[model samples]
Target: MRVVIGEDSVLLREGLVRLLNTSGFEVLAALGDAETTLTAVEEHQPDLVVIDVRMPPSFTDEGLRAALVIRRQWPSIAVLVLSQYVEEQFASELLSGNTRGVGYLLKDRVADVGEFLAALRRVAEGGTALDPEVVAQILVRRRSAPLDRLTPREQEVLALMAEGRSNSAIAGALFITDSAVGKHVNNIFAKLGLPPADNDHRRVLAVLQYLNERPK
Candidate 1:
């Protein structure tokens, strides 16, 4: 996989370059600012971009805004944003559009190299990989009536789904059988009134419903 990194922190940026290099990824460029990152993307057209949510100058979402622009201009380029904390609004905005090839993880996740690499690979391969904390925030803020209809187990299943966990993964996390996970997923889809479609599409829609719903 080819990648470009955008992080203002010298230590983290160098660390990421080394990490990706050793993990079998070709690092095209390591940039410090959002503008240069965008330019690098245009120049390199990498398969994936690993960006910190904040960067140079004002240091308030410049990287995120650049990421949104990258998604707009190069939909095929996967984006994996790292943040110091859970920024629900940013995460929601990033996910509000096409959920494919997108990831939102906290910086703390980087310490777990194996898991972090898994998430990067997942996003690069056109899949979602939201941090567990990000998924939890979205679930907590969801106040839609349809969500209220879900049982506690169903809610748990949906939360794991939002985190982009497969049925077997969800079952393992919940200590349940795959059959039970499937049943709960079906129930979640039915309750959300999602029309029949690709199972992956339905899962994305279910997750979007959680993000799009407003308290009333």
Candidate 2:
């Protein structure tokens, strides 16, 4: 897939591009900052974008802010955000719009080339992908109210669901049958007030909404 790289650190940016290239993905552009990344996206229209959580000028959340703009401007372009740390607020913002093509993986995950590539592919295919760490953080921070209404098993299902795991995948991970997983998922949805008909993105939106509303 054609992909763009955005990171303030030149070394990490080049490293990511080289790794992606070695993994058989085309690097359309490797940019040093969010502004350049945005410009490259407009010009190249890459199939996917790999961006750092923090980028130039502010050395803060420029890449994330840029991702939001890109999502609004070019809803079809898939985005994968990599960060050294977890940012529940940013993840909530990214999926808040209920868009289908987005990923938020921790930078440490890059050590597993296969999983990283898989996440990239999933996002490009119009699926949500969030780091398991981020999910855990969100659960810990918002352990009352909406999330508290869930049973432990239901909470496990919701956590996997937030990590973008499908029914079969979650079942395999939890050592349960797909039907059992589906039942748990339905229960979680009912508790979360997420419509049974909602897809991955909408599920993400509902969960994010719940997390965002929790006391900080």
Candidate 3:
């Protein structure tokens, strides 16, 4: 697969290019800044982009913002973001819409070449690969929110939604009918104050609200 890399660190950028090259991925460009990375992606239209969460200039979410733009402008390109720490907000924003072909992994995972390459391959093949820490933190944030308005069943459905389960899968997990799961999902969306919109995925918005709202 064709790949573009956006990492500010010289050693890391070169290392990633070498690793991906050896793994049979064509490294179109290994860029050091978010802008250059964006330019390269626009120029090459690579199949996948591997980016660090922080990049040159401010070094605070530049890479992430660039990734978001890429996702919006070129939805076909896969994105794999690497962060030194569990930036829950970054992960939440990146996952707020259609999450296919996305990945968020910690930088430490690079040492385990097999796992890192597996994650890259999964994302390139239009699958998700989130770090365990990222998932745990997002769940913890959701749990800390004040959600007294939702019924117990609705809360259960919402939790399953956060796990990226489809309505049918949730129904199977809860041993309920698919219709029941749909009702619970709609209820969760209503309780979260999310109205039906033509361009929005209410299910994703509901989960995002659950993750972002603070305990009242």
Candidate 4:
């Protein structure tokens, strides 16, 4: 797989390039800021882009803006943003289009090499891989009307789903059987009016709905 790295820190950039290369990914470019990342993408057309949340110039959200632009300009390429903070709003904005090929993982989570590589592969194949911490932060915020309708347990299940957990994983996390987790998932889906037909991105759709993305 061809990959691009967008990180301001030289050490982290080199580390990512080395890791990806060791894992058999061709590192087309290890860029410093969003501008160079964008330029590299245009020049290399890599299969996956691993970018940090902050970058040169403002160092606030330039990398995120570049990811958004990449999503708009070239939806085929996958984007996985590694951030130091949870930053739910920025993560939501990246997945705003409601399709796939996007991911947002916390920097600390990178220590788990197995999970990190799995998430990278998942996003590359057009799957959402939001960190569980990201989902928890989103639910930790203020509660709204529609969200108020869901029971606390259902809310917990929904949050796990938003984190890209499978039924078995949720079951393991919640200390329940897979059947029980499946039931909770179905109930949450039904209550949220999310069709079971499109199961792949249902978690993302459920999250977008919970955030009240629809026109008010």
How do the residues 1-216 of candidate 2 rate in per-residue lDDT, one tens digit apiece? 899989888788888888889887999999999999999999999989989888889788888888887887888999989888876555665765665888888887678777878888899889988888877876654443377787999888777876778889999999999999988877776566443221245567655854665457
Q: How many residue pairs clash in each candidate?
A: 0, 0, 0, 0
Candidate 1, which segments miss by more than 4 Å at Cα?
Answer: 144-216
Q: Over all chains combined, what TM-score does candidate 3 have?
A: 0.70
Model 2, residue pairs in steric clash: none
Report the alpha-carbon TM-score of model 2 versus the true structure: 0.64
| Global lDDT of model 1 | 0.86
Task: Predict model 4's lDDT versus the native.
Answer: 0.80
Give per-model TM-scores: 0.66, 0.64, 0.70, 0.65
Candidate 3 local lDDT, 176-199, one digit each (tens): 999999888877765564544335
Candidate 1 per-residue lDDT over residues 83-198, each given as its tens digit: 99776555666776788999999897667899899999999999998888988876654433377798999988988887889999999999999999999998887677553422
Higher-scoring candidate on TM-score, 1 or 2: 1
Q: Is candidate 2 or candidate 3 better by TM-score?
A: 3
RMSD (Cα, Å) for all candidates, in order, is 13.5, 13.3, 10.3, 13.7
All models: lDDT? 0.86, 0.80, 0.86, 0.80
Regions of model 3 farther than 4 Å from truth: 147-216
- In the range 1-216, model 4's lDDT, one tens digit per residue, is 899999999999998888888986899999999998999999999889999989999999999889888887888999999999976555655654645888998898788887888889998988989889877766553233366567888788877876778888888999999998878877766565444331246677677776664335
Q: Give the TM-score of candidate 1.
A: 0.66
Candidate 2 lDDT at 180 equals: 98
